[model samples]
Target chain A: AQTVTQSQPEMSVQEAETVTLSCTYDTSESNYYLFWYKQPPSRQMILVIRQEAYKQQNATENRFSVNFQKAAKSFSLKISDSQLGDTAMYFCAFLTTSGTYKYIFGTGTRLKVLA
Target chain B: DVKVTQSSRYLVKRTGEKVFLECVQDMDHENMFWYRQDPGLGLRLIYFSYDVKMKEKGDIPEGYSVSREKKERFSLILESASTNQTSMYLCASSARTGNSNQPQHFGDGTRLSIL
Candidate 1:
């Protein structure tokens, strides 16, 4: 079984500033994928960024990036130049390359961007 | 753009009532997923379908059943709805290729209240 943990329950960031949401997972699988998803007030889940366990380099998508430390089993999301639209609930998810490809998600971190 | 559409944005039902949540995908994805989201808990997978007529139990399948008659539609059913089942239900779909590591496209979600 795999489990993802988001220690931070809630976070707040100043507008135009940067914020980092921490995430950790316990997985025995060597080949896996890590993802960060954002759910806005509209209740739509959107993919923020993704990182493959085999890829040592972190994944970056515009203002969203991930700090993936495979050895530490840590995958954190960083939002740079945060805006009001960035205020949402963020979740960290894991999926192994084998089996049914079901995703395991963390509890989530609610981020609020302050003006 | 890949779009996942859930049948209802909001629903209210009484206990012991049979509830059906419908999901449809426009991308012809090979995989479809149903998840429930609570206040603190992140998205928890209830069921998933890999192909037409092929369904699999996810992390939490208790009190939930699913049907996949077609490749583009997956339906989640609660045989007897309870107050505990009241939550935001999300539907997602993704392409299942060689590695099956593609990001999932999600619906806006259906907020169900079981009174």
Candidate 2:
């Protein structure tokens, strides 16, 4: 079974500090995509960063980055220099490219960027 | 820019009432999806359409149905609204690329309250 796990239910970080959100997924497919999505309070979610399993190098988008470990099936998001606007619910998602189009999402981590 | 719009941002429906949540995407994406987001459970896919008038069941498709009469529109229907079904409904669209996982563009979710 393919499942994504976000162990941290909630997290807080001081302004200008960095924090990491943990996510671990179980999948047998060698080639796939992992993504970090941010959902602001009472708003829709948007893609933050994406990483392809085949790439050894991690994916980074501005202050957001992902540590994608294919063998271990772990994908975690790191936020650098947290800002007030960054307060939102962060979700980790996995998508298989095997024509099944099965996308699995984790129970999100609510992140708070404190002043 | 891709714009995905849900008909309503908040909806209230009584028990036993039929409900419809509409989604329209202007990007001409071939794939459309419906998902319910609940606390701790993450986002569970209810249904998805790869083409006009074609839909497939997702992880939790019970108590729900979908229609894609047009390529740009996908509608999720609840046969009978129940309290358990009260959650944030998210509609997403993505281009179908056979070889890679395409990131989904989401609309502002509809928060439905079944009372």
Candidate 3:
């Protein structure tokens, strides 16, 4: 079985500051994918960033980046220059290439950007 | 941009009533998914379809059924709505690319309330 864990349930960041949300996962497969999704108050789940397990380089999208450590089984999201619009529920997800390609999601971290 | 749209943004149903939630993706994605989101549990996959008329049960498929008769449309059905089922339901679609790095495009979730 695969499992994803998000340690922090809630976090607050000052405007224009940086914040890192921690995530760790347990999976036996060597080839897989990790993703970070943001759900704002409007309840739209938006893809922030994604990383392939085979890639050593981390994935970065605009102001969001991920620290993916395959050996440690950890994938964390870092938001630089956080703005009020970044306030949302952040979820870390893991996907295996085998079978139907289902995603295993971690319990989310509610992030609030304070001005 | 990929667009995934749910038929309803909010819904209300009664106990023991059969409820249907509809989703459509315009990107011609071969894979579609339905998920339930709660306060701290993040998103739990209820069901998914890899192709038309092919479905698979996800981590939390109990009391839920899904239909995908068309490539662009997926429908989730609740046999009997319950209070516990009152949560945000999200629909997502992703291309069936051979690589595992494809990120899912999600719709604005439907907030369902059962009384």
Candidate 1 regions with alpha-carbon error over 4 angstroms: none
Ranking by TM-score: 2, 1, 3
lDDT of 3 by residue, B1-115 (tens): 9999999999999999999999999989989999998888889999999889999999899999999988999999999998999999999999977754378999998999999
C-alpha TM-score for every candidate? 0.97, 0.97, 0.96
On TM-score, the stronger of 1 and 2 is 2
lDDT of 1 by residue, A1-115 (tens): 8899999999999999999999999988898999999999877889889898999999999999899999899999989999999999999999999855688999999999999
Clashes of each: 0, 0, 0
Interface RMSD of 3: 1.9
Please provide, for model 2 over B25-109, each residue's C-alpha lDDT reduced to its tens digit, 9 standing for 90 to 100: 9999988999999989889999999889999999899999999999999999999989999999999999887665489999999
Any idea what lDDT model 3 has?
0.92
Please tell me which model should have the higher DockQ, number 2 or number 3: 2
lDDT of 1 by residue, B6-53 (tens): 999999999999999999999889989999998888888899888899
lDDT of 2 at A27: 82
